[model samples]
Target: MPHVSLHTPIGDVTVFEHDGAIVALDWGWVEDQAQTALLDRARQQLDAYFDGALRTFDLPLAPVGTPYRRAVWDALCTIPYGETRTYIDIARIAGGSPRSVGQANGRNPIPLIIPCHRVVATGHLGGYSGGEGLPTKRWLLALEQPEGALL
Candidate 1:
């Protein structure tokens, strides 16, 4: 596996590539660092994303999950930027309960790239990973949200 860590507005983010495609993204810097062309591309895309310049990611992703979990993650990618969907909404698409959808969302290996941050409770901001928890979720949502829209 080859990985690289870069500083972003949310803090340090590390991206990992395995067998030539992006496989995971994490919240902090990691030592024993390595990089590949694919990792480099992922980092560039992430940087552009943080700058509000890239709306969609073009890198290949290979997040590990069960079939149902993969479906949940796939549905997450369907969520457009600057918008959000409820766990129930995704459950409807992925064929499960909101709790199940939430579980899979939490397990997403490639968070921002998979756009797991776009899912929320029916009328509330939902949980998130990374160091800051709900505040981190809020920040990601705020980043995608238009200035006039309430976060």
Candidate 2:
């Protein structure tokens, strides 16, 4: 596995590569890492994302999960930047309950790229697995919110 660590505004995000696709994005850095062209590209994209130069990620992703969870994660990808969907919305699309969607979201290995943070509780900020939890989720949503886009 080759991994690249980036220091973003939220925190250090390290993307792990396996079998030529992004497998995970965790917090923190890895010293004496195995670097690859794929990893280098992922690093560039993540840099662009943190800089707000990129909203959607275009990378090869193969997150390990069950079929049901895969569907949930795939549904997460459809959520546009700055926009949000309730767990109920995903439940309808992905064939699971709100609790199941949230659980799947929690288990997502490649989170940021998968855009799991876009899934929220009804009228609530919801939970986040990064940047000290909900604050990080808020920061990410705020990052995507356009100026005056607010009502």
Best by lDDT: 1
lDDT of 2 at 102: 92
Tens digit of lDDT per residue, candidate 2, span 19-71?
99999999887787888999999999888987889988999999999999999
1-151 in candidate 1: lDDT tens per residue?
A: 7899999888898999999888899999999989788988898899999888888999998899899999999999999999999999999999999999999998999999999999999878888876488888888888887777887
**Lowest-scoring 10 consecutive residues by lDDT in candidate 2?**
142-151
Candidate lDDT values, in order: 0.90, 0.88
RMSD of 2: 1.2
Work out the TM-score per prediction: 0.96, 0.95
Clashes of each: 0, 0
Give, for candidate 1, the lowest lDDT window spanning 10 residues: 122-131
Q: Please give the TM-score that candidate 1 achieves against the real structure.
A: 0.96
